[model samples]
Target chain A: GIQVEQSPPDLILQEGANSTLRCNFSDSVNNLQWFHQNPWGQLINLFYIPSGTKQNGRLSATTVATERYSLLYISSSQTTDSGVYFCAVARGSQGNLIFGKGTKLSVKP
Target chain B: DAGVTQSPTHLIKTRGQQVTLRCSPKSGHDTVSWYQQALGQGPQFIFQYYEEEERQRGNFPDRFSGHQFPNYSSELNVNALLLGDSALYLCASSSRQVGYGYTFGSGTRLTVV
Candidate 1:
């Protein structure tokens, strides 16, 4: 089984602040994804960068596949961005995603 | 398009009973995967179905089984449920042609007593 570790288990910031969350995996992966689990428990897709950089609105992500690490960047963060950020990776021949516990982010208004 | 949709947003089952959770993949998606998330934890892979076949599974026991219909809809069945089985069951849909990126549903919150 592969292990995924997320850094800074918890984070807090004021609205409009910037922060970066990181994920490190134990093995090579064919796919990587970042998701935001809202207060309602819905997992919203953020990015699916398995090996490169991608951005969607105020959020961006970069995965250094070779190094087995990925970073999710949030700029001008808003209260709506407050939630748990998850990083998942797919590997092995089975292709099931392995997820890190996640980084809990709280953006106060 | 309707993203992955799960049915019976919440359910309650007793020990030794069986429960089924349903999922309909997002339009144009062909693969369906199921995950379980306990309180404050990331989703844990349960299994994946593609082309109506079980392609991969996690460490879950035989008590956890699933089905995928020809229409790409899916059903997860848990037999002899235990309190430990209580969790938010999530269904995520994706296509290989689209890489492994997935669109997950809101999930079915199941509680076992």
Candidate 2:
């Protein structure tokens, strides 16, 4: 099983601020995804980026597969962005995905 | 299309009791995987099912088991539940042959008393 690590276990910022969350894996991955778990506990799929970069609204993510790491960027953050952001990856062809502990973000208005 | 659907958004049971949770994968998805997310912790994989068969599993015990039906719907059963069994159970579905990630459900919150 591949090990996944997320930095800045927690974060807090004022509304409209920007922040970056990082995730590092121990092995090469075939699948990589970023997720936002809202206060209600629903995992909103952020991005499925095995490599390259992608953006959705004020959020974007970049994955460097060769380096076994990924980054999620939140610009002009809002209160609705307060929740846990998680990074997960699949090491092999098996359908199982390993998840990092996540970085808890709180944006105060 | 409808995303992954889970039943009984919340549940409470006493220790030693048995419980069952259900999940329906997204349309056109043929694989289902179960995960347990404890409070203040990341989700841990439970097991995955494809074609009505258990394919891969995690570190859970036999007390935690699951079944997948012909339609790709699935059920997770826990026997003699303990307080530690309390957590949010998430169901994810994917196209295995396509080698893509998964679309997770909102999850079922289980509280074992």
Candidate 3:
């Protein structure tokens, strides 16, 4: 089994601030995804970056597969971006994903 | 088009009871996966069903069983539930091809008293 660790278990920022959340995995992975769990408990997929970089609106993610780590950046954060951000990784030869505890982000309006 | 849909948004059960949760995959999806997310924690994978068969499973016990229908909809059955079994159960669906991401349902929150 692979261990997934998220940094800064909790975070808070102003509405217009920027932040970076990190995820480190214990082993190599074939799949990696970022998800945001809203206050209403809806898990929304943010990115599916196994490697390289991807940007969606004000949110961007980069995964360095060789280093076994990933980063999620939120720019000019909005109140709607407040939620728990999770990083999940699927190890080689396994379909199940191992998830990080998540970074709980709160963007104050 | 509908994303993943789960049944019984909320459920309450007593210890030693058995409960079933249902999920309908998104359109054009062939695989269904189940996960459990406790309060303040990330979702934990339970099992995945494809082609009406169990293809992959996490560290869950046999008490946590599931079935997939021919249409790709699925059900998760937990027998002899315990207080610890209470959590938000999530259903995610994805296409069979590689590089296909998952679509998650709103999830069913189960509380075992």
User: What TM-scores do the predictions have?
Assistant: 0.97, 0.97, 0.96
Q: Write the per-residue lDDT of candidate 2 for residues B1-113, one digit (tens) a residue.
A: 99999988999999999999999999989999999999999999999999999999999999999999999999999999999999999999988667557999999999999
Query: Can you write out model 3's per-residue Cα lDDT over B1-113, one digit (the tens) per residue?
Result: 98999999999999999999999999998899999998877899999999899999888999999999999999999999999999999999988665457779999999999
- Sliding window of 10 residues with minimal summed lDDT for model 1 chain B: B94-103
lDDT of 1 by residue, B20-55 (tens): 999999999999999999999999999999999999
Docking quality class, candidate 1: medium
Docking class of 2: medium
Encode model 2's per-residue lDDT on A43-66: one tens digit a residue.
989998989999999999999988
Task: Give candidate 3 misplaced runs (Cα > 4 Å).
Answer: A92-94
lDDT at residue B38 of model 1 (Cα atoms): 97
Error of 2 at A103 (Å): 0.4
Candidates ranked, most accurate by TM-score first: 2, 1, 3
> Candidate 2 vs candidate 3: which has greater DockQ?
2
Q: What is the lDDT of residue B3 in candidate 3?
A: 90
- Pairs of residues at least 3 apart in sequence or in different chains that clash in candidate 1: none
